[model samples]
Target chain A: MPQLKAKSLEMRTPQVTKTAVLVIGGAEDKVHGREILRTFFGRAGASNGYITIIPSASREPAIIGGRYTRIFEEMGAKKVEILDIRERDQCESAETKASLEACSGVFLTGGDQLRLCGVLADTPAMEIIRQRVRAGQLTLAGTSAGAAVMGHHMIAGGGSGETPKRSLVDMATGLGFIPEVIVDQHFHNRNRMGRLISAIAAHPDRLGIGIDEDTCAMFERDGWLQAMGKGSVTIVDPTEVTHTNEPHVGASEPLTVHNLRLHILSHGDRFHLYQRTVLPAVHRISS
Target chain B: MPQLKAKSLEMRTPQVTKTAVLVIGGAEDKVHGREILRTFFGRAGASNGYITIIPSASREPAIIGGRYTRIFEEMGAKKVEILDIRERDQCESAETKASLEACSGVFLTGGDQLRLCGVLADTPAMEIIRQRVRAGQLTLAGTSAGAAVMGHHMIAGGGSGETPKRSLVDMATGLGFIPEVIVDQHFHNRNRMGRLISAIAAHPDRLGIGIDEDTCAMFERDGWLQAMGKGSVTIVDPTEVTHTNEPHVGASEPLTVHNLRLHILSHGDRFHLYQRTVLPAVHRISS
Candidate 1:
């Protein structure tokens, strides 16, 4: 019944001013990704905010590796660092922690959510990143695999459309920067409804955010999120569903969800999580 | 904050009023699947209702084809029939239409969502089913594949994990019984958040309902949905998110989502789509 107000694109100008988190969807930092970064941080007075790229994902070497650095440099980033968490040691290195601490904004490049989670689980870098985000000292932004780990529960993937067997797929602990939510990237482009729904069904209390291939849903410090770009994001909440998943069978069976609430947000829309409704603010983009 | 109220439970009474629709998830006749059916329909008076099972879904010969009929017979049903739509003509047969029209409720057995949609698309039987549901003359219930078709859009299967390039399995026309909503079966059991999110992201206006394998979420005449099962259902709505999902050069693109509302519903939970909030009257079923 309530409409979310939109903020001017101009408000995003110099996109780096007081941003507490910078979430980049997979494929961001390409053509539009850089432009998006400029819009957000360019006006912040800094040529570029500290950007840390995590190349631990599968597609990292192909996408965010070599030429990507030059592009970010050209985009006006003052400093760009890449954290290659391919090895266990790299994930725990002192340098990784220092880079995480020194940077104002950490960017996770596209790759594998499972890989990222596996490398960073219980690691010092993860701890530092989490600490910085909670302390409001640094902004955390991730694309693709990076984005998937923002939530406490990361979706590893699984079987066919008919069977939602948890063991069929894998799940790992996420960065937990944003508690109470599960993040999915390349949403519509990949037809990931089955997986996202499976994740929500597994954890009814957690919210599921599915980001489209060319879209980004960013959450601000005040706990409001806005959608920007071409596609939309899917938000799933199962707080009001009645179900009997067991049917008096196995003790540890998959959950069954009944009545649930869902909302879809496109560019410029704002949603308040705590209030659980759309805000009244209007959003606009400025050059 | 309102809670869902249960008008009646079939478990409490062996013989009761038959519903308009009976949706059975995949494997409904299978050992595990039967329990899911018994948990939901067993309590709803599966035997007493005019039941029709779509046997085209079963991988094996519909050996258990008459299982529902027998169950409902014991539950005090006047009659039970099985419809096999395997033949091309059977899908459009006059007998199908007459049987459907004559019945008080229709049951969709679980198998493959794609298969079910393919068999019923544009057929007279499909139209009759849709019309009956809209007219409230028939109670429509589906398990697994059957449930998938309940929504306007259906999720086919695809990729394993969080890869930006994973194919969007497939989406075809469903029964359209539930307008503006996409249904995913075996939701949390298989960690389907990725797929469900993708589906919701593709269609922002539609709400996604991911029912757990053994669980079922029922929508009453008043448009309120209640969950009943051992597991939970995941609802994803992306009305408020901000991000850029544009592709980066040769790299996998990134997606960003923000500020979406999510609610987790278990047994006894209620959600009013019109109000877009959780009702206080609904509460979780304690094991």
Candidate 2:
């Protein structure tokens, strides 16, 4: 009989490839243009990594896609390619595949999340994107719409901020680059509190991150997220909130939210993503 | 300085209203049809209570709006009023105002959440609904789509499961009958886990209730919710989840969900919506 490897032994081996993620708030292009770009290049390891930009996100306008290409080039990136995925066919193009395969860093610019998802769903590019991330060859970064698409579920904006109704926004399948978290940009500035709150109340098990403009949260390989840039990131963890008396009542009933922990993190704050808790001071980056 | 008046204290006193929320999971006009009809009558009460049904909700055969009116009459409701809200003028008709003012309960039948919000937004009927709820004179009950419209924020339906990127579902403002919670019905049957999870993840502080078919969780005045009817209710409390590293990586990033407390409550299980923990058995309702 052949000797069998124990499952525990197999689990002990470290997975190759180091992955880093950068989430820039919607207005990052205007505020921390150079700094955000520098962070991406530095994280990607200037000499070893190639960069690919998905500009289809420009449909939302708030996301400045081409800006990253120019910035990355200026930062001494010899090979910078932009994949203009306007139609579904382009997402499967040979050029798109080549660029994605060669790149160590994939950047998604801000725009319309729905548009981006529509262009990339179930395509060869999507599979490649997932494979590269898993292989640790790619570090995915997004700003605004780009960042929103990084989540498995992306928010498609709709309705007003007045009520916490399900009709206030639209949700679509995102790139599935990150599972179980919903991403919202320009969170505090736009008073997206109602929408974000509704989102969490809808799915209590998932986590939400509302990155303020000019701020970024970097998710390292080990499920750790470190807050970087100006302003603060709001971590809404509803895992403990209880006692919801809602949609069944016809009249507006007072909703009681209990045991919600809100963490406001500025630059240098470190959080363990799976643990959903703030890390100790030792883990935080010195500004 | 103004003297603190006794009347001020009285004004701020918490007024307790006898409100009953009837949640119908499946076949509002067929299965448990009599019970649903009786639900409307119960809301009307013996005194000056009126019942108004919005027909616009039943444009689709599955909605069964007119059936509610017939059931209300069969259940001995003295006054059963049908308000056609499709016409812009009808939203502010004298009949609509009188029906709202004279009635103790307003029945919102099953239909589309988007349609309900669209018809009710900025309307006199909408204002009356809000006033009645605040006055504690209304017991709002909904089935299916009607139930979806009870919360301040409503879910219009979206994607196949929860992956974090936006699903195809849309969220809009609802009647605001219930604040702070997002309600989803036929949760398990329709596999709405992803949508509900997405909603809660976006708003970590709000509570999410996924009521399975034939099951209902009623939020009482004391800030407690009692599960009733057949099947079970899934309460998702994300407050204790440890790590939520989102917006930092690609869609393939493994989600780490730690310490999320999920409660599966059957009939007569009383959950405290505020505390987010299971209350002792002594506080539970005697079924």
TM-score of each: 0.57, 0.49
- Cα displacement (Å) at residue B42, model 1: 10
Which structure among the candidates has the greatest TM-score? 1
CAPRI quality band, candidate 1 = incorrect
Worst 10 residues of 2 chain A by lDDT: A249-258
Give lDDT tens digits, candidate 1, residues B1-287: 12322334434554434343333334434444354455444334445557677756666426655766666565566667888787656867778888988876666766677777777877888888788676766677787777878777777674334432214335677867777677777665555655665566556678877677566677765677766665555566555444323222122322333334455555566666556655532354321
Candidate 1 segments exceeding 4 Å error = A1-16, A32-50, A59-63, A85-104, A118-137, A159-169, A189-206, A238-254, A257-259, A285-287, B1-20, B23-287
Of the native A-B interface contacts, what share survives in model 2? 0.00
Error of 1 at A75 (Å): 2.2
Q: Once model 1 is optimally superposed onto the true structure by TM-score, how far is the C-alpha of residue A182 displaced, in angstroms?
A: 2.6
TM-score of chain A of 2: 0.84
Candidate 1: interface RMSD equals 7.7
